[model samples]
Target: MAHADWSDPTPAAGWTIAHQIAHLAAADTNVLIAVRTPEAFDAVLKRTEAAGSRHADLEAAAGAAKPRSVLLDEWRSGRAEVAAALRDLPTEHGFPWYGSQLTATLMAPLRLMEVWAHGQDVFDAVCAARRPTDRLRQIATLGVIGRELSFHAAELPLTTEPFRVELAGSDGRTWTWGPADAEQRVEGGALDFCLRVTRRRYPAETDLTAVGGDAQAWLDNARVFL
Candidate 1:
């Protein structure tokens, strides 16, 4: 999108198209720092832990102020560097992130999910349709594994009881997680589940149906964040 389009508002409240890209840049930078220097990452965590969302907003605002050409080049270069850094990391490596540890293997997929999710906001802002692709499999898998992440971040009580998830993929197939016979189950379109978990759309607005009270509660609190 052009500079004018960058000013256009996205679905995320108080955020613009530029904000989406800028946020991505900010997040990618954090991932890069985490992988490269643990001590530096700890410093970052210390600084941002106090500011929280405000810190992110400030970073996005700063990134948005740069010239479009500069922003694109910087974001692109940083992402490529991050990819290279991740590639060099040992498969068994673990990095501290946002109050938790993340495996080296999961970083790439998590980054992809963030890119797609933020891109959705930009696409929506510009009235463009982005077709769902097989990449959603990675996101849906993250959504399942990270179901408790949001709870943990929010300091909510955690649950050990598992809930079954069954999603109808865009490719006319089923993707499932957890025990099939679990009493609590969530069944829905894969796209809807991804959007719900990403906090892009309210669960009530999606095609998902919750089969149990716990399932509904999970749907409400579930969110994708590193």
Candidate 2:
């Protein structure tokens, strides 16, 4: 996985480390609404929206209030609850998301990826780097979800076949997913790969390999929603 212990200062001036941590913590909490009540998952959607607004307020106020340690504790607790929900939800259970049904087990990694990706925002606020790992493969695998989202949002037809993603981390282990000879192949360091999908790194500024026409463009506008 492409994991990191990053601690660089976030470039978003209004956002502090505490605010980033709290936003992710809040997002994790919002994801859980889908688990406890599949029929009530619309509430989950609304909650994420609410969380975003709340985070905006928190980011603005972060300059004035709260202890760092206390904020960290709150963030940790919120993450724990999300982890528990991800671990406990059964495979047979499904949640409503954007008019679709998603099994909890399949959705767990998405939740994990969200935490790991957003966690980088906090890490950047402190100027640190985490160790690279195999877990990044799991996270980047979600990039396939991007094609669907792009097609939906841009009103263009995009292929759904898995794009081959290969990463050679700073540690030298090559982590890969999908078939090597697939229509598209994306190669880069674990950090860059994660940063790309998370919309943190622009392809030109990073050592990313995107094969096939419009592959990079596909990635450029890739968003989580349809």
Candidate 3:
């Protein structure tokens, strides 16, 4: 990634590779604040909201002021700080995130999802092929749990019935969610499902198979990020 062209645009619309890394760095800094100082995190949220500025906008502005090397250094340092904070925090501690709260355990996977998703943008910018890994199970699980949020985010009706998801992991093992006897089912590759749910790839572009109305609806509206 260091050797890649930071100014090059990625598949994520108007964002460049440097913007993606900067976004992650900013997000990691926010997470660190959320975990270490609740008041500061609240201030950050308030300031961003008051300015009607999204985190991405703030990140891009910040990134534009610095060179790629500085952004890379901040990103690396911010990640290490967040990691250490999460490691030292109690398991029961829940911090505000987006509009809700998450425990240390839950926050870790969300961070991983961001890293993997943004990493995809970087890879795409450089014309690199990204291989699926067992770690994607974390993202897949998050996507499944975000089913209701997906519907809510899209302002659609939330289905009461639970759907089963069976993804063929890169490790050649099936990662299953919900009940096996569920009426609605989603079956596909883990990477495809992750990308679809993250909105990195649309359902029509992926090989995922949805077996019922609810499952199909989920695929249509799935979003891992809140």
Candidate 4:
């Protein structure tokens, strides 16, 4: 994913343009570090959870640092640093994060989804609409991530059948991920789908649809880590 301009020119009420950018940067930095070092990441996660007590606070703190200008610069610099780190990572090298081991290469796509999804929160907070690109690749990847997480969180058996997830972009293009003949299907706009699984946007706020048993349950608690 290319770098998006961190500007909300005509932002609505509640937050300035800078706050949104800073928020994304803060989260990008944390995930970047976690993917790089498993032990350190796990320790940090435990410590943070202990400090916050509530999961909401933990999520909030990860992206709630103030002073929008500093946040913007930090986001730019941090993304560059993580991008370089990802370039150096070998395919075979794996790091444990959120209770799963993932290859280093997957970090880029994962972080891309994270930045895009959380960035949407800032957008909604500012009341601006954005038509996302043909990012089907990233959206599909995120669907898989969400599927795995939803299953793990619910402690449900992974269904033998596959799922078909389709997201229609703003340009009237369809981006489909997963299987067609599966136990479940979640379909909606790419941006809305991303937001829904990310838990940043509630089902009522987006056009997402969930079919089959446990699909809604899965979406309810989807996360990178519990």
TM-score of 3: 0.96
- Candidate 4: RMSD to truth: 5.2
Candidate 1's TM-score: 0.91
Tens digits of lDDT, candidate 2, 95-195: 77645787766677777777777667656655667775677766666765566676667776776666776788555787777787788777778777677
Residue runs of model 3 more than 4 Å from their true location after superposition: 53-55
Tens digit of per-residue lDDT, candidate 4, span 1-226: 1233434432323333454555556556666766665567877678666866454444444443455455656878998987887778787678666656777577777778767765666566556677767664675566657677678777887766677777787678887767777768877787776666666666788887788766665666555434
Best by TM-score: 3
Runs in model 2 deviating more than 4 A are: 1-9, 37-41, 44-67, 97-99, 159-162, 169-173, 223-226
lDDT of each: 0.85, 0.65, 0.87, 0.64
Cα deviation at 65, candidate 3, in Å, is: 3.0
For candidate 1, give the lDDT of residue 1: 58
TM-score of each: 0.91, 0.74, 0.96, 0.70
Residues 1-226 of candidate 1 have per-residue lDDT tens digits of: 5535687889987788777788898888899888888778988887787887688788788898887778888889989998999899899799888867987788889899999889888878888777898889999999988878867876777777888999999899999999988988989999998998888898778999988877777788888874
lDDT for model 4 comes to: 0.64
Off by over 4 Å in 1: 2-4, 150-157
Q: Using lDDT, give the best candidate's number.
A: 3
- Candidate 1 lDDT at 16 equals 82
Cα error, residue 30 of model 1, in Å, equals 1.8
From the highest TM-score down, the ranking of the candidates is: 3, 1, 2, 4
